[model samples]
Target chain A: MPTIDILLPGFGLDTDQGYPAFCGVFLVRGPDAAGQPRNILVDAAHVGRRPFLWTALADHGLSADDIDTVVLTHAHWDHVQNIDLFPGATLVVHPDERRYAHTPHANDWATPAWTGLLLEQLPVREVGDGEEIIPGVEVLGLPGHSPGSIGLVVHTEAGRATITGDALHFAYVATTGRNPLVFWDADQAARSIGRILDVSDVIYPGHDRPFRLTADGGIDYLAPFALTVTGAGPDTPGLRFADSSARPSWVMPGIQEQRALYEKNADDSARRISRVPRVVRPAAAPRAAGPGSG
Target chain B: MPTIDILLPGFGLDTDQGYPAFCGVFLVRGPDAAGQPRNILVDAAHVGRRPFLWTALADHGLSADDIDTVVLTHAHWDHVQNIDLFPGATLVVHPDERRYAHTPHANDWATPAWTGLLLEQLPVREVGDGEEIIPGVEVLGLPGHSPGSIGLVVHTEAGRATITGDALHFAYVATTGRNPLVFWDADQAARSIGRILDVSDVIYPGHDRPFRLTADGGIDYLAPFALTVTGAGPDTPGLRFADSSARPSWVMPGIQEQRALYEKNADDSARRISRVPRVVRPAAAPRAAGPGSG
Candidate 1:
């Protein structure tokens, strides 16, 4: 049976606010055709975070070279920057996405510099919609966010788990069916979201924590820190592990609220650091006035 | 000097209503590297209309093999079905469009059957946005009607002419800035239309006939049958060849009006045929009376 591990728990309190809100990277471990264990990486994070990604791999007793294959969900900067880290890995992307990467629209987040880098560095294998990348892993073309976004479906003992990169940005976006502000086609985005919801038992969102579909047609938010499933019962719909006392509802904060939360957290951290006393040697600096200071 | 000929004048009174309304194919005659005349076909028409297209080519003293290059604006079924007719031609398409042709969205007009045919048969050379396909021909990626739709800019003796395939469905849509009912992204379509207006003195629309942009930022409708510049002046802003007496306004009829016009035309054609004397069959013989009727 194949197993999945979260190298970084995507976009939550754990990630920096300035960077892309992504679910970092996921590593799938399974036996290859020769029955030897192989590791496949889902997406590489932002450019500056390569060291952190490497450390995470080291923590799992694996190195960059151990990554035999890397499947790109889309060609967005944050999701594809660290592709060069895995030198021996075979790169896979949707054919449409591969083309989009080369000539993205001006309004899109893609940059020519990044596109140039990708063309110069990576040898990519283009895959079609619903095609299997590996024996247990298949791709679903979900266009909207970009021209050629895709979702990965993995068959595991836990059932079908779909790694949706920006296709479903957060649980709130999926459950409430609110179109993301940044998208190529709103109608197509909505349709792709509906399609993803129909097939997957568990969904790993691009920017938020994972969630599972309950048997009774509701969602159960999985715990961010732990990989174990949490609050997964037919009776407990929309349950988040962080707050077990209250039933979960779609609670995506607005931009203002997010900024306020960041500011408040920064203030709190500053206050905690204020408790340490400073050295009293500052008083001597007042005697060194210049001639003009008279 | 290079010249252009309309192989099929897309959608008009001549085209079948049930089929695609498109400015079917264009032949641009220019000197090749060796200073010999060569023909570049802009797009290929629908599947079953090969004979009509062949006859049109023959009328112009050319054959399918005379087309040294076939430049696809997009991979829509109506625009790419007859590519096999010009086997010797080099196929040029936007990189984004080629990718899009491979993995089109379900809601889009792209069909898998057509896409499969294109992929299996065509050896495409992908060009980037603003990249030159030939010495005097440049590609502009216009993403709106489709994710990877493009326009061809040709520097001719008359002026800069843009072959816009579905980017500007009609001159009215372009001048009024009203998006066509069918489009991938309305905003992008509008922007692309504006961009096309800025660059080209004359535009060859995909569906409607060619129109020239006046210096005062108005459109002058070109005569479809004559292929001669009609009403080309800054004073005549909205000029339609259909009615030379009055300036043209947006004349896209509503569904009811269109249906009524079709019905009326069908009735008129039937009436004209009925005018031909029919063979007066002597009263059907008495032997035709059934025993029950008797």
Candidate 2:
């Protein structure tokens, strides 16, 4: 059995202001080659909040060095910034993705300077479609949002859970079959989405809550409430959740936002807090018997 | 003074049935560091037609080994396929482009297997925006089609001629301000086009026939007639020239189409010519007083 912990169930709340709602890191704790428990991290989150990654790991009674492998979905800047935190871990990326990260199109989001500097210090391994990194965890080539974006499918006790980094930005996209706003090839993205739907019953999107396929073939959001955008404008939409008036459980104070606020108003004693990254305890604990349950 | 030869004026005629009408290679004959005559090649056409490149070079009394340097506009497969032909030449590419060539997105037109193999053997030098690769030949960061797509601005005796590889696919795109159907970022492409229009007086596009700018800021096609796609459908259009009903000079028997034709009708005697790359002579010799002429 394996445990998938949402280290930071990233932004989807109206209360989350003045913070970059980019990405979250997930810790996949499973048995290694020798059946000993090993922790693998997916995505590193934006570079500005590296401390939050350390805090999130600490909450699970783990340390940065505990991560044996870092399976990157893609090399977009927001997802690869905190890779330095796991210096000893082996870095695994899709072959095309590794190439894309090194030589990305000008329009695509990539941090060549940062990625280049990190690769110099770490050993990187390339994985392709259907290749297994750990037992029951196979890599899926999901190209559309990127040339080399990949998804990890893990066979858990609950069911098969697929961790799709940006491949499916919002859980709603899976249900509607509409892709995210940004992508490399729209036709290919649409095809990849179809492939994802056929393979997995449970999905953890790059952003938003985890979702499960109901017996009647309907998508069920794990969170009590899910955010919905009202207007067609590209600007940030006013946040409102489905099925509830109260905020969702995953909302937490952003580390960089808090630091900036403290610097801006030094005299505000109430805002002064520890400078370390702290685990954000959700208001309502995630359902124990949900999709990601081991 | 330097000469700019349209080694292969890319497809526009309807006769090019089965060929990929994607790119053309331009030979910029200019003086190098010590005022010695140097032949610099901008972009190498698609890999499928390697013999055509050899024949084109031979037509100009030059050979593959005669090339002094190769300045890549970007790393798209169509533009970099024949890089191996210039083994001894110095390979200069935009730093971002060099990265892009290595790690291109899945949707982008990149032959990673071929590019990777070639890179392993050739040493590539990085060039940045506004940097001069040769005397009077400066590199401009024209990002849109690809992250590291660059344009070469050559100060010739005729005028300032900019070789925009795929950045300005059609002269109409520059005139109408509409981007090509294929692009990485639409906004960035528009900005790059504007920069090109401002800096260069004469332009040589990647796919279409070369066009010069008039005193009234309108584009003037160098050819007697040009091809225009009518109707909204994406399929191939009927060919017609702007000022004349007759076909313009540079149409040739497409190699891929000929191969396909030969395969379909094995007994066709006309199609079964010697399997060697032949020089495609223009119906009318190019003007000696144009932008590329020395």
Candidate 3:
């Protein structure tokens, strides 16, 4: 059987505090009974520590040609920057994501390579909810932040480890019972996070380092790390992980409950806001005015 | 001062449709001052019309190399399939759209080329809401279907024509004031349509043919084409363009009124719903019978 090596590509620092944000690259290699190696690279960095992905692959003495498949956790620039860099690698992503690529006025950050023009020329294969890309890796559809956002689960020798993607941006998101304000659908994200916790023992967030779920159901992190503001006040620092117990709440039921509460409230609030108004209020109306003016 | 010609590209329909969707394309010829004869292709086809664009260009005795600038009104798949086909052309788009391309799971109809991957590889330049790319063309930010959506206003001999992208998918969208349910934000789409109406006399929809906004504030067809829904329920024939007047009150004013109503009631309704109980009443639960329960 061919050996499988999971690679951590590089680390980037949050511009505000200079704390590091890890850029992760996963390399999956193993053989069927036929004994041929199947190689895959999942989610390359668009922001901090981006260069390390290329360097990490080089360090493994593998070129871009060595990667046969690339799976994107989501379409965020941070997660997909190195996509085009993979050259001819066949990209596997959700079908909803395919439509997202076409909507105009959508954001793509400032990176030049992350444009519609490049994706047009690149090779891509569309997958949908609950589908398996390979033997051990399964795609989970988690829409909210965007219609096609997804999480990936890998059944490993140790157990099942799931990459939560943007379903949970940081560990604290699950711990404090606070849903980060920056999301497309707060309710959908909450549901997705709940589903994620039910399925996996460990979670790797899109923005933060890997962490473990604690017995008390909390995300327990060992070391200090950079965090995202996420429309929450800046004081909430995203934590870094070192080992199995490093980030604990991910495995804890207590943390899961908190996340559930936050998700439910936040989502309801957003949906309420999106509906059309029954009465029109004048521009100068007071904030606490009763309904039915305009 | 380059000579420019606007050529419409071919359509991009699948075998399921049997024939290609004859979506329109426009070619812009650089003004007489430059004398170099620069050609621009706008809004490629969604189907069999691929060769149509090429043939139109060749009929004018020009090749792809003569093309210098390519701009899209928006990032729908039908409008942007063959973007890479224009190799050296400097692709101009709204900067906000660049970010939109990277947003996952939204606007699932776009081809990957219209998203981050294309932006990454192409020598693309970003334009702002009111920025001008060429002497006769100006950008107008129009958001609703997608966050970074934009329209292009071209000042020409034919009068000021605005390519509305998907802001007005059909003439009725503007006349009836009815925005589609598929929009990310229907209110935003309505506002954008209103803005586009204020700026130009001629309007071009993403689908269907072009039309002229009449002086009496009504939508009038510039050509003799009608909208037909092929796959709707059998009992009801889909709505047609010819059956309605230029002013569609239901879509336009009714929409505005609905928006007002929803906004007025949103907060109170939200608070009420939030206070509701999550559990259901159970018949089998130990109930107090007339004063005493066993």
| TM-score top scorer | 2
Provide candidate 2's TM-score on chain A: 0.71
What does candidate 1's lDDT look like per residue over B1-294, in tens digits? 567788877553110001223354888887865677778898886543454577788999998767778888877766775676676677887755655444333234233212422332445677767987666778888876665688989888878989988887667666676445433566677788888988987888886678896777677877433221111111223211232222232222232242244344454333332322211112233566667885
For all predictions in the order shown, the interface RMSD in Å is 34.2, 25.2, 28.2
Task: Give TM-score values for chain A, per-prediction.
Answer: 0.71, 0.71, 0.65
Candidate 2 local Cα displacement, residue B134, angstroms: 1.7
lDDT of 2 by residue, A19-112 (tens): 1334647889888678988889998765334445656788899887788888888777557655656666888887666544433332232332
* Per-residue lDDT of B276 in model 1: 23
Error of 2 at B63 (Å): 1.0
Q: Can you rank all candidates by TM-score, best first?
A: 2, 3, 1
Q: Write the per-residue lDDT of candidate 3 for residues A191-260, one digit (tens) a residue.
A: 8778777887766666555667799876765334422211111121232212222233222113324334
Give per-residue CA lDDT, model 2, range B112-187, as digits (tens).
3123323323356888889987788899888866666889998877688889987887676677554553335556
Total backbone collisions, model 1 = 4
- Supply the TM-score for candidate 1: 0.38
| Of candidates 3 and 2, the better by lDDT | 2
Best-to-worst order by DockQ is: 3, 2, 1
Candidate 1 Cα outliers beyond 4 Å, as residue runs: A1-294, B12-19, B181-183, B215-217, B225-294
TM-score result, candidate 2: 0.40
Cα error, candidate 1, residue A49 (Å): 51
Model 2 lDDT vs. the true structure?
A: 0.60
Instruction: Give the RMSD in angstroms, all C-alphas superposed, for model 1.
Output: 27.6
